[model samples]
Target: MSSAYKTSAVENTSKYGPFTKMVDVYGLKILGLGNVGGQPQVSTEFLNKTAETFKLLLDPNAAGINKKSREKALKGLTSYNVIQRVGVKAHITHTRQALIAAKYRAGTKSMTSIDQEQTSSGICDLMGGPTLLLEQAQITENLEHALHTITQFALPAAFPQEMNISSKNGKASGISGDLYKALREAIANGVYDDSDYSRQR
Candidate 1:
């Protein structure tokens, strides 16, 4: 339910208390797609709906998901829902590009209507895209938010031993070692769900 990475993050093994730290959750990095993903600029109108990782939790036909995994994810909001910071660097000129512009990241402030928030998500979407459809862009925005829940919230909360990592300083233990390889292999073979979290020496 709670993120457990509470106030100020004081020590390697000591500080976190029991409150839901808004800062920790709020600052959680969601989506970070950029133009430099090496693909040429498409019409800013394209919404990559195929990467629907968020929709996985709402599967009515999720017979593959165990009961425990299903319950843990579908808890908050009576369902699910946003991304915070986004990197922006599109060269959308008004005459040629219609809506987007060449600039730094857009912040969530310059809105005159309930629908026109300043923030953007999933690449260059804050200023809308080539389709010129308001509703479509809004849907893309919401999808970015849901992306965070699966990656940072519910999955780690339900299966901490497997998903969460341990470390000192900055190097994460077992990340590139034998344990990491075993875990990677297990998931590839569809056996990760049955494997133990603890790594044996």
Candidate 2:
């Protein structure tokens, strides 16, 4: 393996945990034990480091304030939903990487790259040239499409109920000006573009 590949493999494994779904210890040993006659050997420290890295990678708060922007900028989003969506994206990215590695290992492809690079337009692309762009684009497009379904179908179906509201006119309604204010503040400060007050409305 080239130094780049080795470095990325170690980093990714450290971040994502052994890629267990694709990597077979026995098969790796058969390939080479390095010094233990196909028995495979790894240090405990390395394993621990990998665990820590994986923890960081898989954390729902991995992106810190950045992920919050998505929720706050969009209409009718809650903090709870933001964290849930972050988890979903992380899992999807993990699954995509695993599939890539497994396909590469199975010889379905001659070789593949590992690292993701940020483009000038601020989007992410993988190392395999144009194909990586397509893959990432497809993931983004699919997720965006799914969001429409969630809002239109799943959310209404799941939360179909009349929530009571106290009105100043001594009547119960399903609206709250306070909720709108909270949402407005969240959009102004929590989102990326605070200047877009129109979006907050």
Candidate 3:
């Protein structure tokens, strides 16, 4: 996993696309760990493998490559894989925690801190957390690509609302009070995904 991410950084320097590099690094990391994660004794090995992979992805030197005419080719590759992996792990850990929570809900435990902590982690709550690993491995990286990747595939609910805001922004002041009002309404009504944009709101 570590070598895969390191090589991905080197390879992605010439491509200079965040979405593509994210998909590549993520796929490579997951694929490398897939077989190892299946074995009971090697479960911790898989986790360690992913951790080392993140370390290489976060390394400054390997990501500082310059293609004389291009932007920072390795820019988005940093932290993206690590954070995504963190999200995936949190999903797994919280799933187990949810079982613990359920037992508490069933009166198995006097307190529910384990389950409450599981509830606070966002990943496990998304679509019940079952599909989170696949989504993280597959669709999540496309967010940085063309909007169609998000609109048509990764996020459908966000696009129509985004179009609504965009249409209102064509006026004299651009993004008028009506747009703000609509945005606030959308946010208050919980129409957006829990993305960075949503957090900023």
Candidate 4:
């Protein structure tokens, strides 16, 4: 049996928080080993069984999942395919935004024209000024663009509930908050798909 399957079986047996932590540690070790070119030998049956166990753990309703069910409701979040998808989405979004910013900077003669073009192209709406800084960094060799890019990627993935906080309190926060909110909404609304990233190529 796969280590993942064994771990999942153990996880189902205990309600203790430390057990969960141990499972997480083991899972990470397994993932690390896989990354280091020593992938564990696991059967397809084992993997499928482990996935089913995970699905059961994630579902609030312990009732069996029907094969014909179109949508399965999950109680707890699972890392499953979400992390990979998010990573791809972020990469594609950043690269596309940077290319657009570079193209805009190259073609525009003035700051006003740059702003007009950015607004028209919706780059500003997607990434704010960080992408523009990335393009400027290419010409000026500035390290701040690297820092801005890091900050841009670190923004929260969920929408902010306090929309009026900025206007009501007169406190300025990071510029990426609105961008994160928009991105979250877009994801929830299915505005972008997995195949959307392929179009960038």
Candidate 5:
């Protein structure tokens, strides 16, 4: 972990229960786990946290309000039609440390040394269309990329070997190193598409 990962767990009032939020040195929040009664809070908070995390992923230097990523993440979050798509079924468990894994992905993916960092946390399988579907024609695709990035790259970095999500049937498998580079490059070049916002148009 290289002391890069920091955990902040708070005991909430009886109404909310306790929750654990994990962040890295960049102030990028990586995970949010519900504790005790907090499990119910996860569904509501997950989307916003996930949005913030995506913004941090794209622009680590971003701070304050990030309305763009938030809005886009919202649309994307609703458009993950995974079963409809013919994506492959595979599983991968990250045994590497969080920081190390992040660095590896960032490095091999050719990320620039962040001048600074700021941050937030669903996560799921990857499902993007041509030209990334992120820097493309819709918010749905953008979300697909965002979720993919989180599920494949970010979650593994956060949870490491325990990245699997249990399902009613069993456990489903989980990305690679190259697509991440593409995401960084596209977003850096201001290629995120916002043509059709889900349920807003």
Candidate 6:
């Protein structure tokens, strides 16, 4: 019955097509007949404006380039895997916001001053916060530890085979042959540094 609830219901219906019935069992007219089963309409001019807005957001300095070229570049960038990663990060941020809201409502945790300040500043959404930072740092540390573990296991298994190949006619074999040849050439040319050898050992 609240304005907020009505607004949310309308928005939800707009996203998906409208429902079959306009009124619920309570005999209250929720949606008009015209709106029922109707898809949201988007204008071509509106789409063009949106594309221009995003182009400016992505590359503000692209003033010299024409609109079509800028749009083409923007399309290519959006098609890349980086856009998928951005979508994933956005989803995670939204999920965190929902969890924080639930915790605040349940009185389980106090909302931070930063969150209150952000809300007061007319920013209703809390995307990146301390939680996001902690998550990113934890992921980075885990990745570094995994890489270290993998290298530790791989090098001992690979070193003896490489040594055997290098000792035979000074020719390296297998997938690492090119890398081995480059290293030997660098050492022969006195370009290979041994300063880190002691540290590595």
Winning candidate number (TM-score): 1
Better of 1 and 4 by lDDT: 1
Model 2 lDDT per residue over 1-201, tens place: 222111122211221223321211101110110112121233333333333332332233565634433222222222112111011222345545444444323222111122221122434444343544544554454344334323432233233332112245543233445443454568678664446454532
CA-lDDT, candidates in order: 0.35, 0.30, 0.30, 0.25, 0.32, 0.29
Q: Give the per-residue lDDT digits (tens) of candidate 1, residues 1-201.
A: 244211122112111111111122222212222332332222112222212323344453577767666555444212233222222223222212322332333233111101112233343435443653445565654455455445444554456556553343344443543445676788789976633544542
Model 5 RMSD in Å is 19.4
Q: Tell me which residue pairs clash in candidate 6.
A: none
Worst-scoring 10-residue span by lDDT in model 4:
110-119
Q: For candidate 4, write residues 17-38 as lDDT tens digits.
A: 1111112211211110011112
TM-score of each: 0.30, 0.23, 0.21, 0.18, 0.21, 0.18
Q: Model 2: clashing residue pairs?
A: none
> Cα deviation of 73 in candidate 4 (Å)?
7.1
Task: Write model 6 residue lDDT over 88-197, tens digit each, in one string.
Answer: 22133443444344332211211111110010111222234344444444344334432332222222233434422223343233324444667667978999865566
lDDT of 6 at 26: 13
> Measured by TM-score, how close is model 1 to the native structure?
0.30
Give Cα distance to truth, residue 158, candidate 4, Å.
Answer: 13
Q: Between which residue pairs do clashes occur in model 4?
A: none
lDDT assessment of candidate 4: 0.25
Candidate 3 local lDDT, 29-59, one digit each (tens): 2211111112111133333444344345434
Q: How much RMSD separates candidate 3 from the native structure?
A: 15.8
Candidate 6 wrong stretches, greater than 4 Å: 1-55, 58-62, 66-69, 77-117, 122-201
- CA shift of 105, model 5, Å: 14
TM-score, cand. 4: 0.18
